[model samples]
Target: MTKTERQKMQAGEWYCCLDSELSALRHQARVAVHQHNTAPPDPAEILSPPLAALFAGHGENCLIEAPFHCAYGLNISLGSSVYLNAGCTILDTAPVTIGDGTMLGPNVQIYCAQHHKDRALRAQGLEIAYPVTLGSDVWIGGGAIILPGVTIGDGAIVGAGAVVTRSVAAGQTVAGNPARPRNGWSGQ
Candidate 1:
């Protein structure tokens, strides 16, 4: 008869972030992330057992450098050969899909949660989530911020320090804040 906060969140509907269930989930993610960030590196594993278990799915050779953080790790799915450099943060309130061969440079941030515009609603932690998808072979440069509901197509290049507010088409090269397609630029 009634949908849970988690269900609403996954459905891209407005939901309260301060819900007890969501709080508990975030706590669990924090613990795993702390361990992942602080633990000594082991050549044997790309991700620690506890940390790897948090993801919905992760493929072969997926590497996420230390100091990576996610609001809800279970909402992330990484394809084969996906590499995320250090200082990456993903606010995965909704599902985040990284396709095969995608590489994210240091300090890249992906945000899926959009808080309510109303001050009262924001104070209450009300937000809606939208999935962010990166198609195969995409390259996101350092310090780039991919906002909610953006889908980056295959082979696209996102230049450093770009704030991508819109979706990028396949094979496009975009740079600068509010990321627009770069004209006459060959992939050098």
Candidate 2:
């Protein structure tokens, strides 16, 4: 039996993004996202009913500000006390997990899909996806971009405007373009 495009994507194998199932899922996510973004602002509510139901897992007190976008909401999991600021975009072709107390600043982007290097494959919309995990108590500053397959460990701090291409160890502080470790700065 052949694997579905979604299955291949989740397995980190090249798959066509033009598959009908994937397209439908993306459409569903778009509707939910739009509802959440345009709904009447309720200070007490962050994730609207439709948007919350779209996610695979959502823990208590998770707050996602408006203008949040994801390719497929079902691929995202959020733990308790997680806060995502406005204008965050997640291309969640694969699983994206955010542990408890993780806070992401405004305009943060997380990408799970990597397009094929070959021009023909790229033109064909073939890509592979890898899971991205942010452990408990992680803090990602504004405008940070987390690439596919990156795991940020517990208590880690990612600096503003950083492009993280690699995993960050627990309790580590990373800064700069490629997100290298910084000696000090606990990010408190």
The models' CA-based lDDT, in order, is: 0.93, 0.93
User: Model 1: per-residue lDDT, tens digit, 104-183?
Assistant: 99999999999999999999989999999999999999999999999999999999999999999999999888899997
At residue 178, give the lDDT of candidate 1: 86
Error of 2 at 102 (Å): 0.4
Q: With candidate 1 superimposed using the best TM-score fit, by how many Å does residue 119's alpha carbon deviate from the native?
A: 1.0
Q: How do the residues 68-151 of candidate 2 rate in per-residue lDDT, one tens digit apiece? A: 999999999999999999999999999999999999999999999999999998999999999999999999999999999999
Give the residue spans of candidate 1 off by over 4 A. Answer: 186-188
- TM-scores of the models, in the given order? 0.97, 0.97
Query: RMSD to the native, candidate 2?
Result: 1.1
